[model samples]
Each structure stands twice: as structure tokens, then as C-alpha cells.
Target: MRSTLPTFNEVWQRQCRSSILSDEKQFFSKNTFLVACSGGMDSMLLLCLLHCLFPQRVRAMYVNHQLQPDNEVWATFVQNFCEWHNIPYLIKKVQVAKGNLEAQARHARFNAFQQTICSEEILVLAHHQQDQAETFLLRLFSGAGVNGLKAMQKIAVKENIKIWRPLLDVPREKIEQWIKQDSIPYVTDQTNFDEHYDRAWARHTLWNVIKPRFPKMQTAITRTALLMQDADEILYEVLQQDFKCCGNENSLDIQALNDLTPARRRQLLSWWLKTEYRPSLDTVDRLQNEVMYARTDAQAQFFVKPFWYVRYQGKIYRLTEQQKKPKQYEIEIFDCQNIVLNQKYGLNKDLLKESLMLYPRIGGERVHLHGRVGTWPLKKAIQEAQIFPWQRDQIQILKKEDVILGIITPQGFWLAQSDYCVPNGWLPKLDGVSV
Candidate 1:
């Protein structure tokens, strides 16, 4: 009699043909599959399966944390396996930071993967349904919100590195059975059953007890995480619409942000910050209460690690750490010669021979702006131009001897003095403000 259970190859093929994994199949067909192998049963099976399916496209990467005493032995085993299978592989050694061993190891492992994998290659992980369930539970216990509770995704992109977990929904038992049936050589890590680590405690202790009472607990938890992911997608769609009305690429209108409900306001702030920086919940709360709702005249600013969100002139501008501006510089211009001033705002060839001094705003200065009748106070002019407060110091004042020649604002606008005005002369490119 034939066995009732399907073989590992049959299950893999079925999964690849499934509607959910059809896109992944197409992606893998076109991209190189770089598997993260740990020399354990799960990773070994993943590497073996991918190599069998796509021999020419499969490669393995092993990150050695040097935590366990047998790490070298495990690495050697993986190298031998890859060599036997004629698969190309790389072994990366990473220094795990001195802290929580599990978290540090994971961080080091992913950092190694990110540095090793190129843009065109796809990093494949062996996280299965049981791991997903544990992640969900861990995040829930740690007071994580919906975003965290959603846990691991089947496909994810981090720092421009694409990661695929094809076996995310597959049962761990299936992988074990396949490895046993195939007699695959794999090294077991004793730390997995130590119960000292959080994941080990969850798996060996908590899960062992829970499974006896609720056999389907893993399935239930995984299903809940999937539901949370669906909810997160809907929330993100709503956030996009809200952001469109209240925010632009780099700034958000204060009044419009205030118009949103408290929860939505926090969500928008969190979403905006997460686009480029990871902010904690406390930081978001402070931004809402201390910065966003501060007095109109108050110069409120909040620092969020390498970036600052400052409330200025009815808007919140996200800015990097301000760089020190030079006091002054000199440039020469000749007639019939066009000069490139940085990437944007080039001087006209019609300007006569002159030497101009570029100085930062020192106060009590005036500029006779082109097309304007009288001289305007430099402060008033910058305010009228709506230049950001943090950017005002970056504005350069152009002066030929005692007379103001022009002013270069951070917005890439060249407010040329009336004396230096030439029609259809200065080309505006607006790339970035550079001296």
C-alpha cells in the first residue's frame, strides 16, 4: 500500500502553484535565490529544496555569530553540504553585540545578510508557521500594537534588500519528516532546547504545555496574525488618504494634522517618521503633545535620533542635523562667462567683471531685490520667501564691495539685486543648496 502522505517534492510543487505563491514563483524564476542556511533541519531542507528546483539559481549564505562552541563545526558541515551539491556558498562572520544574546544575534545575522546580498539577489529564509506563531505571541506579550502583532510576512523588503520566506505557512513537522525521509545530514544546535533564550522558552516550555491542552494553538495564532496583517493594510490605505490632505513629501501642515482625530494624528505621525526613521511610541506621543500642539509662538522641536522634527510657521519640517555654515567666501565673475553656482542657480554671462563675497546673514542687512522698487530688510525678505527657520543660516548674501549683489536661499532661489539683474539670464535647476 502506498503512503497516504504526500512527499516533500509534491508539497513544494503544490505550494509553488498555489495562488498565494504564484507571484513568488515568478519572482524566484527571474532572481537568484540566496538561502540563509543555519546548518539546522529547517534551513538545510530549504537550501536543498531550492537547489533541486533551481540548480543554477540557488546559493547559500551562512552567518556565523561565534556564540556556540560548535559554531565552527556547524559552518564546516554547511560548507561540505554545499560543496557536495555543487552549490556556491558564502560564510560570513558577524560580531554579536554585548546585550540580549537572541536579539543581538538576530540583528547581526540580518546585518550580515543585508551587506552580503546585492540588489538583484533575493534572500530566502526558512521561517515556518510555528515561528510565525511564536513571533505573534512574543510581540503581543511585549505590548506591541497591530503593526508588530502582524509578525513576519511571507515577502518583505528591508533597507532595499528583498527577503522571501516560502515556507512561512508550512508546518515544521513537514520539514522534519522530509529531512528524515531523505536522510539529509544536518547539525543540531543544542541551544534550541536550553530554555534560556526567549524563543527556546516559548518553544520548548510554553508551547509544549499549551499543545497538550490546545493542539491547534499554533494554527490559531498564525491565523490571527494574518488577520492583523489584513487590518494593517486597511489602516495604511486610510493613512495614505489622510496624508494626502495634510502632508507633502517633507512637511505636514499643522492645522490639517490637528483636524485629524487623536488616534489618526498619532498614526500619521508614526507613518511619516517610519518612512525614513524608526521612532518609538513615546517619541510619537511627545511629538503630538509637546511639539504638534505647542503654542503658535513657541519654538518647539523634537529630536528623533539623527533627525529633528521642528514646528515652524504652521508646518512641521523634518530636518537632518544642521551642519555648520561657513562665515564667508568669495567668487569672481567675468563678462560673457556663465558660472555654475553649485548644482542649481547659475550666474548670467551678461554680468560684468566683478568679485562677489558670499556671507551668511548677520542681521540689519538690506537687499534691493530685482523688479522691486525699494530695498527690503534681509530678515523680512527671508520671512516673505517662507524660508525655514533652520535653513535661514544657510542663505548666502552676495555682495560686490559694499553693494548687495544677490542672495542665495536654501530653496535654490537667487534673489539677485536690481543692479545685477539680467533678463533670461540665470538658469534655475534647483538640485540642492551647495556653496
Candidate 2:
């Protein structure tokens, strides 16, 4: 006779033990395990298993989103359960944001977790194979690519905190059966059955229809997700190479990127955005078509959620919220008798003692500098000199009253030397040295 398959309880215990010994076991062994308990079946079951395995190493946290009438009751139940088991527990209250009920609640809960859990602690959650399958299907229907389809990871690092989902590979039915076999009691959140949430709708309606047609649908979908996850790992290796070649802290090199095919360009763009933001597939496609291929002279910009991408000077740069203020300064040329301007104009005693007003762009300002015949717009001069638009406010224009004398910049000085030439035998030096 063939050997009997292990019971759900035995299999669960084995999986838990196996997971506890994985590479991250060192992390759990060294750090306190913070279990996110919601008083629900999945979380309570996980809490019980962890308490049984390593009682001293774990503590439980219940986040009260206050979305439902029974939130307090759920909190009471969690507290009572923990107290009865002599397990450490905490109840945290959070005010969920007003938009996108599901997303806001999740954000608030995670925010609580982040605020409460320190870097040395690892957070344990109870997401299972069914949840992963639902996420995979939802992402697939929403036109997600390989990365998004990979769905929830068994282990993730966020905000310097390690999150370990121990039951990510375990099926929900198995968890339920294990709970039943152990006589463990857990509260049910009414919202899970209400079906207003996307996840609930997927589980109750879509999953019901799909599972009967294909009895092993959840396992099959999860396997596909694992395959996609493998593909995602390969893509990540390519991403690192591309990023190394064409990326910087805040900008990407367009010239090095142009050597890549359009598909490769898209891949790099997607990878680049993923480092900071999670852009939709449509958004990534638009970025590749509208921004990457635009004319050199064309100014292209796009917003991916909270960040702004700007294309200029053969590079793509992420816009930061830095305020540039136009400033004016007065410098006495006589005081600069030993100062060299632009490594060419050396202030000498023969140069008249005069005060020069330095101002940033004030419309209609024109400069006739560096032996230029006709006057050109100060803005045009700055542009021709390859100054970025955002740096315009910081450009210092050397002036006498309303007349333009020259321009002083960090790179070099562009002064009208003919009008203010240094006399013979007077040298400008920083340390009594002539250049």
C-alpha cells in the first residue's frame, strides 16, 4: 500500500518548522518576531502556531482601523486570547485616510506597523496561497507584466523593516483544516464576506467560478506566479546592469540609453521607475513613446504618481521640490584688486573703484559681453552658455545701474573686459601668485 499523505496539522507543523530554519531564521532567532494579529482566522492561526513553537520569541499586535462597528469587539477578543495564552500583545489605533478604502486601511495598518516595529524586529503576516492567487489574477486582469504578477513575496524589506509571510506557500483550506483540527477559535471579519472590497469580490465571486472549472486553479495560478517570479529575478539582473551603465542617483543618461533598442529602452525605463515608484503598465508605455523618443529640442515631462520626470540636455532627471530664489548682491570692484574674474579679468588699482550690482534674470535684460557686437538677451546668453532653466535664478549678472556689465557663474565668469580692463603691472592673485 502507498504511504498515506500527512495530515493538515502535521504538514503545517512541518512547513512552519521548515520556514523557521530558512536563511532568515537567523533574523528571527536574533530579533523579536512581531505578529500582525487582526483577530481573524488566518492571523489567529498563525499567532497560535508561533506561540506554540517559540513562545518567548514572539509578540502580537492588533491594529484597529475603526472601519466597522465590531472593531472594538475584535480588539477585545484578541486581547483576551493573548491574555489567556500569556502572550504579549499590543492594540494600536489608527485613523485611516479618506480615499480608496482598501488602500487607505492597508496604508494606515502598515504605517502603524512601521511606527511600532523597530529595525531589529521582524513582522510576521499570514498571507497564504489563495491570497497570492487572487493577487496574481487581479494583476493579470489589470494588464500587469511579470513583476506585478509575481505578487506578494514571502519575504520583503520595507522602510528598513523585514516582513516575513510564513504561510505564503500554504493553502487557505489547509490553514482552515489545521485550525479545525487543533480546535482553535478565531473571529470572522464581516467585511470579508460583504464583497465590497476587490479582494473579497475576487475570492467570493471570481474564485468560486474559476475553482470548480479547474479544481487545482489556486495551486496552478500560484505555480505560474512562481515562474513569473523567477523571470522577474532574471529581469532584475538585467536591470542592475542597465542601471549601472545608464543611471545615476537622480538622472539617466539618454546617449548611453539610445544605444539600446526600443524594447530595451522600455525595460530600462520600467526598471528605473521601479527603483522609486510603481508605475502602471500604461504609464510605462507612455513614458517610452512620448518622453524617450521626443525631439532633442522638445521639452517632455510626465508624472508617475508623486514624482515628476523631466527630459533636458540629453538626460532624464527626476524633479525635486527645491525652491530657487532670485538674489542680488553688490560687489565693489576696487575691493577685488587682487581677484581674478574668469581667469582673465584681473582687478587692478587702475580699474576705477566702482560698485557693481549683481542680479538674476529681470526681463528684457541684455548683455554685450566678451567682445560681442550686438546685445543679446541675458536669458539667451545663459541658454547658449548651456545653463539649465532651474539654475537661471542663481546666475549672477554683473551690472552698473540698469546697464549690463558681465555675468558671474560657478563654472566661469563672462565679464565685459574691454570696458573694465586692468591697468599694466597690476596682477590679481589669491596667495600672492600670478596666473
C-alpha-based local distance difference test score of model 1: 0.76
* Backbone clash count, each prediction separately: 0, 0
Weakest ten-residue segment in model 1 by summed lDDT: 326-335
Which run of 10 residues does model 2 get worst, by summed lDDT? 425-434
Q: Tell me, what's the RMSD of every candidate?
A: 5.4, 7.4
lDDT of 2: 0.75
* Candidate 2 ranges beyond 4 A from true positions: 1-12, 23-27, 275-277, 321-358, 362-385, 393-435
Q: Write the per-residue lDDT of candidate 2 for residues 253-316, one digit (tens) a residue.
A: 8888888777777777876777444666677788766677777677687777556677877787
In model 2, the number of clashes is 0
The lDDT per prediction is 0.76, 0.75
Best candidate, TM-score: 1
Residue 198 miss distance in model 2 (angstroms): 1.5
Q: What is the lDDT of residue 245 in candidate 1?
A: 98
